[model samples]
Target: MNQRIRNCAAAAGLLFTAMTASAANYTAMLTGPKEAPPNSSTGMGAAFVKFDAASHVLEVDVAFGGLLGTTTAAHIHCCTDTPNTGTAGIATETPTFGGFPLGVTSGAYSNTYNTSLAASWNPAFLSSHGGTTAGAESAFAAGLASGAAYLNIHSSLYPTGEIRGFLTGAAPPVPEPASFAMLGLGVPAMLLVARRRRKA
Candidate 1:
């Protein structure tokens, strides 16, 4: 391609990136949720979460080695930063996603993560549900920027929380607030500048 064409392509690419970035997101720090024991002997597995601010949705995927005889209750509660400190919060109820309850409050959970529990990816889930929702990329950004957000797993074995983590930061690639903002503006501005330069 010609130099002029290449420059324009680059500018278009940058703009595309800006629009793709959502509000907040997160990812698993360590793969513990997978190896950790379940809240109950009946429960044993790891839970994974991912979210996208652009789509305004969270996905809660849990892989249990097995479940209690009847799968009674499950919940995603909040506790101290370090395991077993103090009860920070808990998930009272969950809205249905697809056919399963998008929640982590009862021990007998239906194991459904692909759901839009919250109409939008507000930081509220962090203060309340913790490890329950799609606390991945955008979730972390929104939660931390807003202040307060976390993750947790609960079951009949451990009513409070078997495993938990904080939504302190996002996985990566998701631009930081400042970065996102700059790109959101910078790319367009650059294109305008380029057009003017070509005209001149």
Candidate 2:
């Protein structure tokens, strides 16, 4: 193999890695009345999340508005039997969100949880649902796919949950290893042919 072949191999490796590794996205629409303990308050919320399968990293962005009282805490809950009903264990890094000294009725919250880290799981969840971080993440991902995962926001008025919404959307699957291998071979074959053509 010559320099051209080596460069082609490197490029194919990168492409294969890129194809096999990617993130899954999920979103939710929350409302006060959607809470497990429903309320007549005019509050609402929206959440967007990305789960990186390769790294087990969960990135979340949630915004809420019009709560009847000051916001206190929030979390991602999982393994609910049905949407808009019941409560499950927290799935994010903390049971209660931090950093808010004086809670507000409306604001946005963001967080990143490494699903591979034990600290990122609610204790009860770890015990009942999954014993390890990876196991919990797998369960959470399954819940999201089945619309059993939700975002729950707590407020001073409703300490349980002022607003909530079940996460929805099936993330696209990562490419299979065989597909990656085939593509990798094809790239080198094409490169070799092109090199031969240039020589001719």
Predicted structure with the largest lDDT when compared to the true one? 2
1-200 per-residue lDDT for model 2 (tens digits): 59999999999999867844566667676776678767887776566676765677787766566678887778889888875468887877575754522378766666677778778778777777658776777787777777788888888898888878877764223334543243344333433443353233
Candidate 1: misplaced stretches above 4 Å? Answer: 1-5, 19-42, 69-85, 90-98, 101-200
Which candidate has the highest TM-score of all?
A: 2
Q: lDDT of each prediction vs. the true structure?
A: 0.38, 0.69
Q: What's the lDDT of the predicted structure labeled candidate 1?
A: 0.38
- Provide backbone clash counts, one per model: 29, 0
Clashing pairs in 2: none
RMSD of each: 15.2, 14.5
After superposition, candidate 2 runs with Cα above 4 Å error: 1-22, 98-102, 170-200
Q: Candidate 2 overall Cα lDDT vs. reference?
A: 0.69
